[model samples]
Target chain A: MIPVEYMSVILMIVFGFVGMARKFPRELGATVAYTAMLFALAVFGERLGRIVYGLLYRGNPEAAPDLALVQWFVILAFIGAWVVMVYAGQTLSFAGKWPPNAVTGLVFDMLIGLFNGWIVVWTAWQYTHRLGYPQQALGWFVPPLSERASRWVALAPLELIPDGQEPWVLGGFLAFLVFLRVVR
Target chain B: MILSLQHELNKLAFAVLRPVLGGPNPAITPPTGASTGAGVGIDGQVVATAIPMLGADLSAATLVLVGLAAAIGFVRGVRREAITLMVAAAASLIVGWMWPAVASLVNRLWRMFHFAVIERGILAENPMAAWGEAQASAPLLPLGGDAAAWQIGFFVFGLLILGYGATRYVAAPPPKARGIRGFSVLLERVVGAMVGALTGILVSRFVLPRLVPNAQVALLGPGTSLYDRLAPYAPTTILGIVLLLILFGVTGIGGGKPRQKMYQ
Candidate 1:
């Protein structure tokens, strides 16, 4: 199999180009906003899912659907939130008084896009490699699930510079590219 | 100061990372052996547990608040005000760094002053008894706790100052007056940079330390001494300023003339 880390790097590079081509700070801003939202979901999503399950089932664990169903709901919610945030960001960027100018906005979008793209890839890698699935992965905050989940997601795929540092390298390169574009 | 900062950072890190690292679990679950309490989880095991009421996990709440703030800042075009805000933020970090000593000194002075008054008053014959009585009575000042509280208070105060400064600068009358416009813009930039710097420092001190614990000591420097911690953040402060300058230099920092298209 192609190294997962390499796959992430390739994903980041491709995303970087997409970001540059979009060339709107709002697009970058939207990505950041989405990332933040995703982070919130990752931290709280599972709990929310359980709460919904509890309220619906009313203390009857058997009344709830299988674990996979709950996991799918959480995953779908995450995707929904991402879509909403991106759309909201795009709308606000046009409606609001940010980015000041087109060129600056484009640069801002490009840089943020690069950073965000890396974050997505990293999170995905963590999901596939660390946690078996999105629900179990994000549910790691809870002790019971974490104990069970650790067996599957504990080991990181071996990489050249540790999976954590990939974004910085990718972002820095993207920033350099923007700087060159501006100065040139 | 370092210890307190570390404590706060640990809390923040656990809040942010636990969910990401650990799988789905209840926000606050009682320890395996305990009926109720606060505790720290290490590697999937609860290591320390305390009063259940105090054990409420605030990480999710904090994350939400931070996310809101970040969204607002980005939406408000706060980056446009980066230069001035960075400077202010840097200054705030230095103040936060020195706050422990300042708080200690103030505490000493207050105690001495209180004792002096007690000694000279009607309770002069039994000062210790009078001090005890005073302790029993409601405090004259509502202030409570140690340097950590004061440090947090100062951090909030700095944010308020920055917020107010930014609002005033942005709301200033257009440069219709002779030389006033140029001066106003200059002041706005300064204030904006200061706000950005203060926000940066707050993030560094509270959020960054936990997210990147290893980078924390490096950013704050070696040793527990205030100078050591304060000196390292200076680069972060300087970098904020430099970033603002570069941002403006390239973007041409809005030359006072209104653009024809608002969303270009």
Candidate 2:
């Protein structure tokens, strides 16, 4: 069986190549949606998680949400966003101008797709840790992460972004993206 | 001898530019009453260390380089600059992350080469001591100082390959593109310049220093260039710039003639 770390990395690579195959316009829509979702998670994921547990799980003050439930919740959320953006006829689209030409454009498409994949994997990391690594019990992740995976965790987006300004920085970037979109 | 000639050239360039970058201006005289930062003085810090041919701070040169980079970016426009952004970010990030692995790979190859050719082939009669003798005879160049040279070789080779690959994907902009108006054209240059400056900094300040240790000490070491402060936080900076570039893309910054479907 492949280690969880190796599996997730392969998944990311697959998403990148898939994006390359889809080309840029559809990929761009997917990217914007993914990044917007990441921004939402960064800002309100914790509060929303609590709201779900309280409203649906009897609000039992002492009992935490099930790890499987949380994992499924995060997974479903990303899948929902991907569907809405990539397939729902609302993706950011531009066939010709921006990527300049074909070979480089495909590379750019792959990179953006890779970025989205990273966001997905990174979100899983945050949710798992926020609820205390529920995957450890299910044999998805073992105690004492391998050294390479540990390095990967160390480079987690906000964790690596210094000065505790992750939310502000992320929000500002999203706003700018939206502004440019609106202007054009 | 070639290295010495290169050193002489560095000295000659420094001597010519010293009055401009290092020496005080002869144009304006300071009044006697002026404090003039007299205690530290202009030459005090430099003279103390006494390293000639490299005393210039490079702050002025950095600005000029940045300006040149901005001009290059302006010409490239938004699409090309955006593409270059990813390439630059990849180059810097890869250089930062892969050095140890590359160095290790080189070491293993060297060991295999030494065993196969040097030990068994050339000096088979006394193979045991031959490798040791070769290592000891010359401490530089082919003997073993190739470590630093190897690092440079890897850098140049990687850069050339990546650059050559990029050219296939990127081409010159057509002389005039239809349907592009004032704001879009202006925006292209503006964004292009911004992207260009960032890529320039990524290459020169972030990438080059890490690749070449000797240049790092001479140029970006503590108190060497103002860009040194940002170099240490390169990963974080690259992450931010990557996000920003994506944010800038996916919009109407690109306006041009229709594109043909590629690889058909």
Candidate 3:
């Protein structure tokens, strides 16, 4: 039996490849494959947890998780970031009459990604367990901007604030690169 | 702000599903008409953690299978890639649900293969260890009852929406182009394999050990730490990345184009 984490990724790759092989040969196929794998894993995640949980409890299937706000935020963030990155890449790289340099496009998107990272980390800091902790750890500036703003809801509830998942963003950008490489 | 948010949502849907609709080499040319609802933000919460908290059961293999099936239509003279993908997605979803074990088996085999090639020193260090940290910290959902049902329903719905939207909005490529198909296929596999192998080593050597120390338990148990227990497995991980690259590269070349048949 393989370890669960590996199982998850492998599952992703297999489904991803299969999806790619099918009708949607591009990123869409990979996305569906990824989605499918994620769905399957979501279903069996707890069952896999039995590797850890079985020692203590009988591991009833009933004990799973409710979609928490944090979880939702993360999911939305990944999908959002992925989409933004790809679109941005497409717009900058291909939207105009002339195609931009692929390298330039890649760099341009990386900068945008960095900007996004800054914003997410900054936003996350306002509500993190320790307000300035995550920021200081990363060495960034976060002025009150407004003392009154601090008193008010930072933007929304902590859960509601988008947490800017970076991997998905990067994935989108890379997907663009992959797409470009394939099409060009 | 609200408008921007909506726009982002539209983009997210498009970004996430674009790959499914377009294939690796999506047509870059603008669509003939302006498609409505162009949001771009994916719900980060879905895939942030090692485990998908919400709907995300389809494995990479299943994803690939769906793509291949969809591709088969294109190869057979199907013009509407979107519809082909949509059908393939549905078919693959059912197939994946029915044979979860098969998905799991494929995952294991790939991991093993990924570990093998990397261990031989073909690429940077494999990062299977990072997977541990990724898993340890990866997001988890708290869906109490009916994990299967909830996940299945969500998966189907998302795919359907994606299918409908893609078919409706995206345009097909102009005429048959020679060599483009062959070129894109090779590129996708090579890139996928390279990224997989390099990341595998990085995770094992640097990321995993730090984030999720090797031990018998997460906090405290008879053993030291989760990482410690996993230390032995590090070498095995390196091997997997290499093998994964080889396998994907080989398989990619063998895999043909998508079917061109559109909405039949």
What's the lDDT of the predicted structure labeled candidate 2?
A: 0.56
* Residue range A1-66, candidate 3, lDDT tens digits: 343233333433543343232222233323322333333333432343334344434565466332
Give candidate 1 regions above 4 Å deviation.
A1-184, B1-30, B38-59, B71-76, B79-99, B108-148, B162-249, B253-264
Query: What TM-score, to 2 decimal places, does chain A of model 1 have?
Result: 0.47
Docking class of 2: incorrect
Identify the candidate with maximal lDDT.
2
Query: Model 2: what is its DockQ?
Result: 0.16
Candidate 1, A19-128: lDDT as tens digits: 65544433434444544554454455456666666677777777766554564565556655675556544432322234454533444445555555655555544544
Candidate 1 chain A has its poorest 10 consecutive residues by lDDT at A152-161
Worst 10 residues of 3 chain B by lDDT: B213-222
Root-mean-square deviation of every model: 21.0, 11.2, 29.3
Write model 3 residue lDDT over B159-247, tens digit each, in one string: 44554335434423312432345544443334333433222232222211221222111121112233357655543453353233322
Q: What is the TM-score of chain B in candidate 1?
A: 0.39
Report fnat for all candidates as fractions from 0 to 1: 0.02, 0.26, 0.00
Q: Each candidate's DockQ score against the native complex?
A: 0.02, 0.16, 0.01
